[model samples]
Every structure is written in C-alpha cells, then in structure tokens.
Target chain A: MSTAKISLRGVHKAFGANSVLNGIDMDIAEGTVVSLIGPSGSGKSTLLRCINLLEPIDDGEILLDGIDISLPGFDANPVRRRIGMVFQNFNLFPHMSVEDNITLSPVRTLGVNKSLARAKAVELLERFGLADKVNAFPDQLSGGQQQRVAIIRALAIEPEVLLLDEITSSLDPELVGEVLDVVRELKTSGMTLVLATHEMGFARDISDLVCVLYSGHIIEQGLPSQVFSAPQSERAQQFLERIIRAGRL
Target chain B: MGTITGRRAAYERARKRRSTVVATVSSLAVVTAIVVLVPKMPRWDRVHESFFNGERFAHSLPRLLDAFVLDIKIFAWSMPAIVVLALLVAITRNSRSAALFPLRILTIAYTDIMRGVPIILWIYLIGFGVPGLGIERPWNSPLIWGSVALVLTYASYIAEVFRAGIESVHESQRAAARSLGLSSWQTMRHVVLPQAIRRVIPPLMNDMVSLQKDVALVSLIGPIEILRQAGIDKSKFANFTPYIAAAAIFLLITIPLTRTTDWLIERERRRTTGTRIS
Candidate 1:
C-alpha cells in the first residue's frame, strides 16, 4: 500500500448533469499492470483522465508518490510529466515529424539537451521498429504506426505511470496487433500501466489486476484470473457474459 | 481487349476536343461582339479618348509607376506591423488565464473599435487629428500617421482571422500538448500557433491583397501615392487617363496576387481529408 504508485480515494466526477465517476477508490501498486474494462461511458476514460489531472474530479484525493495532486490549484505540469497518457484517438501532433514529437516534451519540459533528446528519440524509434519513420509526419503513417510512435512519445518523457485510454480501439483489425505487441513489450519491462481497454484477451493476458466498472462504479477488481474466471458482482457477471458472447473474452 | 482500350482512349480524346472547341468558340464570340459592337455607340470616340488615350497612357505611366513605389513601401511596412499586432491581439483574446481577463477585454475593445470605424474615417482622424496635436516635424508627417491608421484598422480584421484559425485547432491538440507536461504558453507557441498560422494563410493573403489596394486610400490624406499623383497629372493634362493608368498598375499587382491566393487555397483544400465536392 505504501508503494502504491497511484491512489484514488472517494473520487467523483460529473459533467453538468451526468455523473461519470462516482465514489470510487483504487490503489495501483508499483511495477504492476492494471486494466479497466467496462462498457462505453462507464467512467474508465474519466477515471484515467482524473489520475492524469486532465480533468479535475468533483471530489477526491488522488495521490501520486504520496502527494494529493487533486488539491485545488495544484500545478499539474510537474505531475503530468511523471504520468503519461495514450489517447483513444492517437492524438499525435500532425504538424511535427515523428522524431520531433517524441523529443518535444523532454526538451521543452525537462530541459533535456536537444541533441540528447533527439538521440533518445532515435533509439526509441529503432526499438519500436519505426527507425525509418523518424522524419515522417503523423498523417503519413498508418494508424498502427502512429499509435506506436505515440507510445514512443509517451515513453520519451520516461513517466513513472502510464495511463492508456482505449489506445487500440481506433485501429484497423489487422493493425491492432502491432500496437498491442508494443503494450505487451511494455508489460515485460516492469512499467506500471493503467489501461482502459476493450481488448479482453489482451487485457487478460497482460494485466496483473482487472477492474470491472459499471454505472461509474468499480463493481469488482481482483487478480485477472479471479475476475475473468469468477466475477463476484452480478453486474460484472452480466458484463463479462456480453464480452464472452462477442468472442472478446 | 487492346482494341477496346484504344477505342476508349479515342473516345476520351474526342470528348476533350469537343469541350475545348466549344469553350474557345464561345469565348471568341463574346470577344468579337465587344470589339465590333462597343465602338458603334455614338459617343465611342469621346469615351476612348478620355479613358484609353494612347498618349495620356504613355505620358502618365512613368509618374504613376514612380508614385506606386511609395504605395508599395507603405504596404510593405504596414503588413508586417499588422501581422504582428494582430497575432498578439488574437492570442490575447484566446488566452484562458484569469489574470489576463483584463487584457482579453482590452483586446476585444480594441478590435471592436478599430473594426467598427470606417477605414476612411480613421485615416482622416489619425491622419489629420494626430498632426493637429501640434506634434513636431517628421513625426507629424501625414504619411506616418496615415500608415498607423491603416495598421490599426487592418490589424483588427486580421486578428479575427487569426482568432478563427486558433479556434479551429482541435481542443484535443491542446490536451495532448498539456498532457505532455508543456506549459500552456509553450503549448500555444509550439503546438497551436504554427498550425493556426498555416491554416489561415489563404485568408491572410486575401487580406493583404485588400491592404495593397487600400494603400491608395492614404493618398486621400496626403503623400503623393499613385492615386494622388494621378490627380496631379489629371489637373495638369486635363484628362483622366492617369487614373486609368493608376488602375492598370494596381490590377497588374492585385490580379496575380488574387490568383496566388486561390492557388494556395486549392492546394490546402486538396491536402486535407473530409467532405469534398466531386
């Protein structure tokens, strides 16, 4: 518990009249992978965004490295530097070259030297098998390649926690494997990842813990095996049954 | 199969030839009608002598061209000033800082006032009213004040253009930048402004074409730019050809510029994806 990389306590978030996240609590330990799987609009993305401080929660305490980052007027930049997010839409900067996109945050935010940042970018691109695309713009790359580069861009900042929000949901069926492969690689590297995903099989294979959310509540969470094989909550059972029927589980 | 392909190619060629012939014949008929029928009007000689007199055209061309250099200089200096001021105002208006709320209001007021007033009235007020303040020589010159009026007026219009460009950038782009730990200002400078400026170049160029022609407006206050010089020539020669010569020079520059703007707009349209007409 002391080593929990991210801790959310009694979190609640609402947009105007519709509540998205409600009275939720979770602790993600260091160097473990957690997957949040739920129906669309079930607060998975909202929970991830709250942890990253992209959206301010209506009421909660989000602790990152033992600091309450959800406090009023908390400077989120330094916090965000330690937590990376990969979006559902693969929001890569279209005007920038792949290499530049990866190097920008490190150079601008971290004050890393330009040449060193670029060298690191090249190494990361090479590791991702995107060495030849270092100078290509995002529009020139396929959806899979762009997502891979986005992962590389997130990695360049060397974040302690990575929050991925349905990163593979937008890719073509044939292209989803490439990005999932990168996630699998990350899982083996001991990075703490919190993913909101629809890829049930991949989530089951990689996640140490699986959380089932319904109606903005984490109805069940436990070891992936326990959650997948025997969901305790009725809502979790119904949700998993639908996923099973879709051949996703 | 080869015979079928050859026949298709021949058919395509015939269609192209037919369209080209029709276009050329229609254009020629319009030109011939204007050429033959226009002079048949009773006062054609008077109209031609006043407007298209060969001697006056040649006589006024050199002086008008010389005066036009002044117009070019005014346009050149005013454009950069307008661009810089407009960008600042646009960014100020777009800022989300609570501390900058006053600045945002100021920018809104500035743009509203500048745009609400007619450019001519501004030229008169700043051009005459400022000098009437008993300012010293050189600084009091109408050219300096007149150029300032043009800059202020045009910057307001251009600022809105820039603001439109800024707003057009997707909010997700800003979120992505912010999530990367870049400060809001850094996000704007690197991620937003570059894209915004690129998107607005076509409209910005259109504004510049208008700005170029409106440089002639300064002649109303003073500074013997082409239009003013044309007046001088007309009074001296007692003919209106100088005005026509001045117009020709403006058309020579503006037409090409207008065409270039269209080309850029077309190229930009082709580069992006979305709903497109066939």
Candidate 2:
C-alpha cells in the first residue's frame, strides 16, 4: 500500500437509497494499468468517478501518493489536477477547435503560455495521426478522432494518473481499434492508468491487475490470467462463465 | 433518366410559379379590401380626419423624429448597463459555494422582485420616487432615473434569459470541465459561457427589441420622448395623427431589428445542423 500510487479504503457512495460503491479497498502500484471489469450498473463507472473526485464519496479515504485526499475540506481541484479523466461520451468542448480543447486546461489551469500549450497540442495531434484536425471542431471529427483528441487533452496537463471511463465504449466497432491503440501506446510509456472498461480482451492484454465488480463490491481482484482462467469465487466464476458463453472472453 | 429528370424539373418550376401567383393574389385581395372597405364605414370621415390626416402627420413628423433621438440615446446607453449587470447577476445566481449561499439568495430575491414589478411601476418608483427626495437639479433629472429604471427592470429579464441558457448546458460538460481541474468560475468562463451566450443570443435579441419599444414607457415619468411629444402634438392639433407618426417611427427602427434577429436565429440553426435550410 505504501508503494501504491492510488489506494482506496472503505470507500462508500450512494444515491438516495441506491448504494453504488460499498467498502471498496484497492492499491494501484505506480506505473501499472488497473482494469475494472463488471456488468452494467455494477459501480465500475462510479468507482472511477469517485477516484477522480468528480463524484464525492459518502465515506472512506482515497489516498494519492500516501496523502488522504478524500478527507473533508481537502481541496479537490489540486487533486483532480493530478488525476486526468476521459469520458465515454468524449465530452470535448464543442465550441473549441481541437487545438483549443487540448490547450485550454494547460493554459488556464496550469498557467502554461498559450504558444507553448499550442505547440504541445500540435505535437500530440500529430502523434495521433490527427495533425489535419487541429483546426476542426469536435463535431467535425469522427468519434475515433475525437476520443484520441480527448486523450491528448488529458495528457497535455501531464497528470500523474489517468482515469479512463469506458473511453472506447462509444466508438463504432471498426473505430474502436484507433482509440485502443492510443491506450496501448500509453501503457508502453508507463503512465499509471485506472480504466473502467467492458473490453474484456483489451483488459486482459494490458492490465497488470483486474478487478471484477458485482453489484457494488470488488468480487474478485487478481492477475488477469488467474481471474480469466481459474475457478474462483462463485460469483466471479459465474461472471466469467457468462462472458465465455457470450463469446466476449 | 434524363427525360424523367427534365420533366420533374418542369413540374417543380410550375409548382413554384403557381404558389407565387396564389400568394400575390391573396395579398392583393386583403390590401384592396382594407383600402376600399375602410372608407365605407359610417364614421370614416371623422376617423380619417383624426387618425390619418396627412397634413397633421406631416406637421408632427419632424418633431416626433427629433424626439425619437432621445429614445435612441436612452436605449444605447441603457443597453450596455443592462447587459453588464444582467451577466453579473446571472453569474452570482449560479454560485454553488456554501459561503456564497446568502449572496445567491440575495440575487434570487433581486431578480424575483425586479421581474415581479411592471416596468411602468419601476419607472414610476425609481423615476418619480427618487426625484421626490429633492436631490436638486441634474442629479434628480428624470432622464437619469428613468434610464436607471430601464436598466434594472430589463437586467432582471435578461438575467433570467442568461440563467436559462446556463442551465440548458448539460451537467456532463460541467463534469468534464471539473475533471480537467478547472475551478467552477473557470469552467463557466471558458467552457460554459461561450456556449451559453451563443445559444441565448436570439432570445437576448428578442428582449432587446422589446426594450426598444418599451423605452416609450419612460415618457410616463416626465421625459418628452417620442410618445410624449406625440401626446403634446395631439393636444395642440386636436388629432391623433401624431400617434400614428410616432408608431411609424418606432416601426422604422424595430422592423430592421426584428429582421436581423430572424436572420441570426436562422444562421445559428443552420450552423448547428451544418445544413442549408433549402
């Protein structure tokens, strides 16, 4: 836990009467990818949101670099600055051009100079094979291109941890590869990543640790090879069996 | 295929021509009926003498146009004040901090009270009531107070428009902004307001058009704007022709503004859809 880049302990969240994340505890070691896999409405997205501080926790501590960030009166802004998030909907600012979208946070939040931020944006866009799209608006780009730009926008701030919430879930089946390719590149570059995703094969390929959530709890957490192959808890086994039955694993 | 397409083109052209002819004929009929039937009424002579006397209209036209300049002056100056104050009020109302809760409540009450009162009553209270404090010359001038009334009342309405625009933005966008580490104020300034202001321009222009006409209400407090000048001309000439002239003057300005608003709205619609109306 001391070496963990992110650690969650007894985290709980609920909306009205519906409890979402119940007593979650996990440690994400530095420079490793952690994949959260679960059925829909199983609190995967809620857990990612709580970690990013987009959603406030009802109880417990989320520690970043040994600091208890979820304690009351802790400023979430500075913590969020250290954690970048990409959404399923690719919530890129529609009114801004791709260049502007990528540069906005760096320029405004980090006080980076405009020209310098823009240079970083151009470099990221070029690396993603989207150099021609710098002047284009989000609506003008394909879903794949927009999601890649979203990743670049997050990377522009150079956050220590990146949280991806089903980043490729909204892309066309054919367009999914382009986005996943970026995630593959990120893995090689050694950024600590926590992603809530439904792509079972991609999760198996890239994640050092896989956590299978059911209802609102971590039902299983282990190496992907162990969880994907061996018989384990009844619920985890049932989940894998269903995935195999559906030809998704 | 060529012949078929040619025949379809001819059919389309014929359809357009037929519609145009029908529209023109119907419009002509309405105009002709108004012109011919209006004079046939029993009191047409008296009504014509009072309301449509061309000589009286000509006599009052120059004074009404001159007084209309005051309306324009008041409008031009009041508009900036209204827009600035309304944006401030709207942003104030959007504050979410527990510390700003009282300030937020104050803004809500401000908008409620300002919007609940009629513009005329606002003009009377701020215009007459303020001047009644006997502040002496230029400071107590009704023009200044009347413009202030216009600013306050219109700011409330525009602030509500701005609030609606702000709320129309999806919560996801806020989440996206916050996730990027933008402070709430930064989120609004950079991500939210740019979109909100664009979406609300048509409504804001509509409000401006209404304000252009409502400037006349200021005449009730004491400034001899076009409406008041028309009243003065009415008593002197014992005819209502000046009122028509005043209406004509207002239409002259508002018609172009209304058309420009429509053009802007259509352009925005086309922009969002990325399609031509045709």
Task: Kindly report, for each predicted structure in the order presented, the TM-score of its chain A compared with the true chain A.
Answer: 0.98, 0.98
Give the per-residue lDDT of model 2 (tens digit) for A1-249: 487999999999999999999999999998999999988999999999999888889999999999999888889888888999999999998888889999999999999999999999999888889999898878778899989999999999899999999999999999999999999999999999999998899999999999999988999999999988884889889888888899987
* lDDT tens readout by residue for model 2, B156-251: 999999998998888889998999899999999999988899899988988999999999899998889999999999999899999999999998
Q: On a 0 to 100 scale, what is the lDDT of residue B238 in model 1?
A: 86
Tens-digit lDDT track for model 1 on B48-77?
Answer: 998888999999999999999999999999
Q: Which residue pairs does candidate 1 place in steric collision? A: none
| Residue A70 local lDDT, model 1 | 99
* Pairs that collide, model 2: none
Instruction: Report fnat, model 2.
Output: 0.65
**Chain B TM for prediction 1:** 0.90
**What TM-score do all the candidates reach, one by one?**
0.94, 0.93
Best-matching candidate per DockQ: 2
For model 1, the superposed segments whose C-alpha errors exceed 4 Å read B1-25, B259-278
